[model samples]
Target: MSSERGETVAPDWPHPSLGNDLTPRVAAALAAAIDVPDFGTDVDATLAWAVATGADVATAPLAEAWQLLASTAFVDVGAARIIEPHLDALRILAEAQRDGVAADLSSLGADESSMWGVFAAEGSGMRLTARTSPGGWTISGTKPWCSLATSLTHALVTAWIDDDTRGLFAISLRGPDVVCHEGPWHARGLSQVVSAPIDLDGTRAVPVGGPGWYLSRRGFAEGGVSVAAAWWGAACALLVPLRHAARTERADQIALLHLGEVDAAMWSARASLMAAAEEFSHDGGDTLVASRVRTIVAHAAEQALRSSDHALGPAPLVGDAAHARRVADLGLYLRQHHGERDTARIGRDLVRGPASW
Candidate 1:
């Protein structure tokens, strides 16, 4: 999912010197509107800002698109949590259209006003299935980890197309047959975005792609790395106070040491992503490229969390609402990486043979 472009459009808040562009303007607007602690409270307003800004992932260069996601996450992980999926859903839809796997976009009602969520996480004992009907397709059963299910207008859900394969389908969340179940999601971190289960009873849906196509597409891996880019931004958000503390005159040697190590890790992670973006821009998506970069960025984010705790102590975590929320948000968000499991996967890839490097 690489787009050739003439200029770079960096987001405004995190890096103003990157210059003025449509993405920067969107970033600036998001920065001003999103309140870190109270994020996800007003889904409509936040999504409205996004729709108004017209940030289409297909149009931007991969590097710039990732930068925008990272910058938004730097503001608030909750905002990133909302925006990233919307952007990913858009890209997924676009990929389906370009590959000629889906029908006209209008059939899915993919207009300017829609905010989408990607509901693909499967829970034990909960199986969502899709079947062909006279009225196109219908999805039934429950989908777990549907974040903001009640708030979002539409979602790209993955359901078992058959016993052997899963297919991606687009469904309107506001349908009468859809039921958003509350409770059971009581995590302190990222609590604002309630990821509850939703049950669909013969709800009509449009197939985005055939069985196995969603996971098989190149955009799947590339879209994953973009999520890691947001993770890196959230890590940067956590270290803001620590970086400031290390610069003060009374800064202790221990603070400086922690800051130095964390800074080095973050710098290396940033460089890795930049290099990955360059390669992806030229060669498109590769599983090895995505795996390597995600592992590096996830480790860097873990370092930020550990160093921020050790260097800053509990003061900010206890008193500063924004900082405390960022810490908690990042801590939970990093779990998406799968930690050592991801590392082991990368190791297996390396053991097989050398990558394109």
Candidate 2:
């Protein structure tokens, strides 16, 4: 819970959208309803509240509310809470599939849910496995980065077991053998994400499907779309404030024009991502389309962030405004889990055939 330098930064004003009074009240209500443990901070509590609330609300309303509350404080709270529930659901679905039980996953609102799974690296860092046992199997390895590790309840960890290499396991968060260490994540932006190293110390875990669970055609395709959605959400966080700053602040015509272009590109990127997500849900997941969506969204996000910085000038760097923190957070969050490299791979896959490594 302390910064790397042990420097105590001053407490920032509560996010404007959350309001001084209302945000706390909502957070309190959310804490009371959810079963979050005592280990997390206030931001963690708040994120749980926002996601739980947003998940049940209508899509437009949820997005509107998220826009209002999209601050470092709110995002920290929301991302922690949002990731776990979806991860738990995914575990159940994957387990059901493994056990030969058919499931109707459409009702879970696939488009809105976040993917909270973990994939391991072989030998040095990138190997997959799944060892079997009579009672239950055990998974041991390290995942490069788990974005919501601090708050995630379960993770789909990939590993190599026995002769099979590409294996998957649904590991519970509350298990004894699992050790989640907060890794060194010192970046200029997205300071709150806590995308750290997680050590699974021979943890007892339930197997999900079989070998090729993660890299298989279906899983890879769906995963691409899910990652695209997350990137799109981050893009919107930047766009909303850029639009406000452009309309209200005294900026040049060129700045306004650049803002317009960024907005258009972001919207187009979102549409493409959503279309791919819908396709995955409808056509049982398509890797080609998913890779294309991921590539487009990554480019769009980079463009949007750069344009926002250009339009807002030094405003984002000076004040402790929610917009400023969001920009910083997005910059860091986008880099998590081989973000740029993954984006490049997606592009390469689009040009070539199916994706590999």
Q: After superposition, how far is residue 136 of candidate 1 from its true place, in Å?
A: 1.4
Candidate 1 lDDT over residue span 97-172, tens digit each: 7888964546656677888889999999999999996778899999998988878888999999889899999988
lDDT (tens digit, per residue) of candidate 2 on 1-357: 223101111224222231123444345433443354421234465445444554442222222332222332233323532443343344345535655743343332233433344544343653434456785677666776665576655566667766646665666655676666666877556555556667777677665565565566344555444444555655655655565666775767977786788878777875775465455545665666766666676777778878877877786667635555556655665553365676676577657775532
Runs of candidate 1 exceeding 4 Å displacement: 1-41, 105-110
- Best candidate (score: TM-score): 1
Span of ten consecutive residues with least summed lDDT in model 2: 1-10
For the record, the alpha-carbon RMSD of candidate 1 to the native fold, in angstroms, is: 6.0
Worst 10 residues of 1 by lDDT: 1-10
- Candidate lDDT scores, in order, read 0.77, 0.52
* All candidates: TM-score: 0.88, 0.68
